[model samples]
Target chain A: MADEEKEQQKQGEMEELPVILQLRPVPAITPVEEQFLKKFRFLKAWESSMPTELFLTTYAQSVRVLLCHGGTPVTADTIRCLPSLQCVIATSAGLNHIDLTECRKRDIAIANAGDCYSENGADYAIGLLLDVLRQFSASDRYVRQGLWPVKGAYPLGSKLGGKQVGIVGLGHIGSEVAKRLVAFGCSISYNSRKKKPSVAFPFYSDVRDLAANSDALILCCGLTKETYHIINRDVLLALGEKGVIINIGRGAIIDEKELIQCLMQGEIGGAGLDVFENEPDVPKELLAMDNVVLSPHKAVLTPEAIVSLQDLLMANLEAFFSNKPLVSEVKDE
Target chain B: MADEEKEQQKQGEMEELPVILQLRPVPAITPVEEQFLKKFRFLKAWESSMPTELFLTTYAQSVRVLLCHGGTPVTADTIRCLPSLQCVIATSAGLNHIDLTECRKRDIAIANAGDCYSENGADYAIGLLLDVLRQFSASDRYVRQGLWPVKGAYPLGSKLGGKQVGIVGLGHIGSEVAKRLVAFGCSISYNSRKKKPSVAFPFYSDVRDLAANSDALILCCGLTKETYHIINRDVLLALGEKGVIINIGRGAIIDEKELIQCLMQGEIGGAGLDVFENEPDVPKELLAMDNVVLSPHKAVLTPEAIVSLQDLLMANLEAFFSNKPLVSEVKDE
Candidate 1:
């Protein structure tokens, strides 16, 4: 109850709060992020005028946890600068931005926004796919431009029922897509790095083989060396002219130039792209195509998803600081 | 067999083929219609310069079946003119164009498209719903117009999961919608003429009640005298400012003028309308709205559906001629 004892208790409590570091600002900070700020102190590298190297060096000794997002790269050089970093938690389903090899080498635990974005991402993928297949967006444009009365009937859209949908990457998002598609009477199959032992749908290790049998192909895998340019000209040709491509995964997974050429030549029927080779710089050719549906790389967005992400990031950080198991740890392959 | 006897036999077979009367040309005639022509004799009314009445009078005596599409109305007078008519087979799911009362009075059997268009209709309804709720069409327009770079990120869309969806007819299309929405983790309920005995979803006799409880309402019922203007201003108001209405059913099912007013005033959040009170002529006010997705009354147009429609029509015609139970018979209530 003494004044000296109370001061010491306050100091100890303050010292116990972990120092979390962020290289960049989160695209959209939520209430959950605000709550994290109140619970634990943060070292915002972006806020400081010092160079990133100087900022990291100054805070390296105390910083044990690193927070990252999809767009921000957490490279080996950045990891090397943070000598005390024990864990890296990402607010995205894919951890391509994080240097996984370095994390594994240093024994630094990695966690991602596991299933938090799956439902929304899958829903968006299906939305994009439907927009392309059903010509919902194109027909909407037709109606909006005062063309309905003048044009009589808009062009007929293809039915979703009985479509052979080939899912690339039978992970959480892909599984959700399959589940939704099944309800619409779409037949599901998949192509993944490895065949999922638990899945009942037919699996093809090669993307080209999957595309050959499918009326539509939905991309839902992470971006890595193995997956980059996976959907090249061969896959497009295998898909044929009636095939639609729905890419919700990272853009580079598909060869952008080849896709554009294929789409232009009608080698592929249509496309629904949520991401492109470059963010915010969509190919001008796609802007004029009625069969294409373009989104601003926002398949994994929704207020609900963002809130869950905040909770998940906080959970991983809390677990790491207390020496407990990370909630959604990503093992190195 | 002598050549003269063989020729006579072929002539007899040709004469035995039933005569089918067409009040109007079926637009976008498929190979199925061509097949019908090859198998049976068609009394094409438009081929003659005679008025429709005179054409019916001349041809009606021999016509045993009436072939019609969605736009062609089969009035009581038309049915009365055809004394030999035994059945009316419609190429659309809705029977609003056919005089059900007159058919019942004349003892003429009715066979609709049945479940041929249900899957496609439901699929399109879901597509429109997704487009409106997630702003897929609007976002596509944004991307196409090249505003993404200038206007940062598009606003976050509401997730389809965990939302309450009320279907306005627990029939084939409505049930399909419920099934699809269920897989998206949406809670489903419904409003129909009478509570379906077999359906597990909660039912409301009044549409306003359903709207009051649901975040979105998908209209999938046929337009009838009792159901016309069912989704009135009261229902829209009940749906609240955040509620979305998706109509794959006939126009006039929702009061068009009231709906326009509701949308303009923000009394309702959004709409995904495939049909209109005066279709081919959507309200000019809705043209610029991003929240509403306007389809060209095309919730049930697909090549697969058209092919199925042909098969159903032929089956019904064959069943009628053979005195067997109709495959897709619609009885008068």
Candidate 2:
């Protein structure tokens, strides 16, 4: 017993010190997410919203790295508070929230899980399309209201087959959405910044022209300064009465006031939205209309997406720690 | 001007024909639906609903055959009134609304478009499955209620992949539903009066056992005296908490009161209903729950289904007129 106690004490003395760092709340991470986190032996994981002071005090110790997930923006104050922080890993495609210039000045190696959410976003885009075309959501409401034996000309729903679908962005998610739409017997076309030779679909140089021709327009491109409020009143009006616009991209990509105006004026038939500009606070005007289907910014919260993101984040972390090329790096451009 | 006056007189004669059976309102009809009617020398075409007397008087004269569609039941009085009616072609699967006994006694041939609606029903079954499993409808409601940043631990929705789906019937629509469910990675099992040699899926001898084991139970069986209210309270109770029930068949096949009881007591998780016992007027109790998804008795009302049904009906009518064997004749078993 005495020898065992002495051995335990020696083992404790040789144990490595813990690395303390703040980890923000991520979407439901699966077993795969945990497996990736297991590699960081010296790090402490916080799965909830923690105060800045607590994070700073922890960073003052052995912590040299911090991780954020779910496209959370890392403010200048967050970085300034953690003096010892040298690395920031964000498990999301977009890094708009992170102050990259400050990170570069602080010599912090930054990486994000880019394009990992493409499949999830595309899946959601298809779901929204089906919901709108099939009138599933509206029918559900009607049924719940004891309005079965649907009034007027019953079963007036249209088939998704043989319709022209216009994709606003032919990026990772957009391309995937296009592929799925094709499977449903839809003709696909798109509008992108630059035309690509790889895609088989016809490309329109202008968004208005694309909208004017398409039965439905899907927004799946990344949000940028130039692309902000890109789908405005003129573009919506151009799409005309038979068009439906589905925004799975950033909400800022659409002009809310203009969209509301067009929807009210019957310029567009319907819309399916996921993300918003100032999220957790959608426009009351949009809610009042029955022609739109809205969702919380949870298009990328599927179990598959969570696991993929975790795997990508771990891959990035391993490369960073070993002084190898990071998996997903952001360029200044 | 004399030629034009002659043509107008001929057109007026054609318009005054006695037989005018209005089919369901559609933007257009397939060439097949119009084939039999084109052969009828005295019949005229109308786009509106027929008055009771006009319908009966037409059947008494040039309208030896009457074609019906949609859910309005043909009463015994209506059948008795049509003394000269030689045949009734119902372009629908269910015959509960049609007085088959009266037609049989009068030696009138009765045919219906049955199997053609199977694919349509299957499509709707999958739509409901996707709607419930993906929480598509629930999420829409949440967004509409101005509930942003959906609070608490959101319920984890299960993927259809690798789950067991039990079909209550192995008939045309049930089999079709099974085919689509299999594509979504579901393991299929079914309960039928007799085992089907064509299908490779396991057949359960008992309905209760099938209900107990299935993740989701889909009803696609026909309504008959022997099978009425087969999925009663006990069968539903056996399904337990995780089970989701979908009814694309006749609502009489399920005990509505018992189903509602189970839903209210939380014995079953959810249900997707397309028909009801006393339809066009759903039970007030069922309308109170958010767990259930509802659609009017219009599952097979798709354009594809409509076109197919009309074609089948026309073919049957042509065969009857030509003294050939009917394609889908109603048999007294």
Provide the TM-score of chain B versus the true chain B for each model in turn. 0.95, 0.81
lDDT of 1 at B169: 81
Task: Provide the TM-score for each candidate, comma-separated.
Answer: 0.95, 0.76
Query: What is the Cα-based lDDT of residue A126 in candidate 2?
Result: 66
Question: DockQ of candidates 1 onward, in order?
Answer: 0.83, 0.30
Docking class of 2: acceptable
- Superposed Cα deviation of residue A8, candidate 1 (Å): 12
Task: Give the alpha carbon lDDT tens digit for every residue of B206-236 in model 1.
Answer: 8999999999999999999988999999999
User: Residue B7 error for model 1, in Å?
Assistant: 10
* Candidate 2 residue lDDT tens string, B1-333: 699999999777655633434333323233443554455433323432676666566546556676665465666786676677777777767676677777778887777776777766776777777666666677778877766565622354545556799999887778877876655558999998888898899999888899988988998877767569999988898888878899988899999999988998899988888788887778888776667777777676777666767667667866877789789887751
Instruction: Please give the range of 10 consecutive residues that has the lowest summed lDDT in model 1 chain A.
Output: A25-34
| Fraction of native Cα-Cα interface contacts (under 8 Å, chains A and B) also present in model 2 | 0.38
Q: Runs in model 1 with CA error above 4 Å?
A: A1-16, B1-16, B28-30
